[model samples]
Target: MKVQVKSFFSVLSGGKPVVRTLDLQEGTTAEDAMKLMKVDFSDGAIILINGRPSNEKSVLSEGDFFVVMPPVSAA
Candidate 1:
């Protein structure tokens, strides 16, 4: 299955966020995908599937869009 994964670390990053197309297993979960993508969401992140709220365990589908938005803070 092919899924699109995107992460927004901070708006101040000047739109350098990463968007990747992952060719994952059929039953791959959102969390697993993040790990495979090497995203540092250890502190926590707002996860969404196709623009809707989702959890780590959510099973992904073909052509699904997964987004990871971490809490923004003043650096």
Candidate 2:
């Protein structure tokens, strides 16, 4: 199964799209995908799977899209 991953910051930068297609086996979780990317999300970061808030253990499926965003604040 192939899953799509994207980062919010990359989209804001207008840089090369952060979207990536990965071939994962069955029963892969969000944490598993993060590990594959070697990303250690900060405590203040928010994770969304297919537009809904999700956690590390959330399971993923083919064609699933994830968006990772850091907490934003205003002074």
Candidate 3:
């Protein structure tokens, strides 16, 4: 299965949005994919799957768009 991952305002790309493709096995969870990419969940990023709000435990499917973005601040 292939999953498209996008990280916005993330450490992975020096706070820039970076899109990448991950070739994973069937039954890969969103958290698992993040781990593969070395995402730091401790930074408190919002997880979105195909633009829908999701969590780390969310299961991933083929052609799924897994997005990680830092929480927006008023400042």
TM-score of 2: 0.74
Clashing pairs in 1: none
Instruction: Give the lDDT ranking, best first.
Output: 1, 3, 2
Tens digits of per-residue lDDT for model 2 on 37-72?
Answer: 555565545779999999888999988998766567
Q: How displaced is residue 31 in candidate 2, in Å?
A: 0.7
**lDDT tens string, model 1, 1-75?**
999998776443676778899999999999999898776766778899999999888999999999988866799
Window of ten residues with lowest summed lDDT in model 2: 8-17
Give TM per candidate: 0.82, 0.74, 0.82
The positional error of residue 18 in candidate 3, measured at the CA in angstroms, is: 1.0
- Best model per lDDT: 1
Local error of candidate 1 at residue 23 (angstroms) = 0.3
Model 2 RMSD to the real structure?
Answer: 2.6
Q: What are the lDDT figures for the candidates, one per model?
A: 0.86, 0.77, 0.85
- List the candidates ranked by TM-score, beginning with the highest: 1, 3, 2
Candidate 3 structure lDDT: 0.85
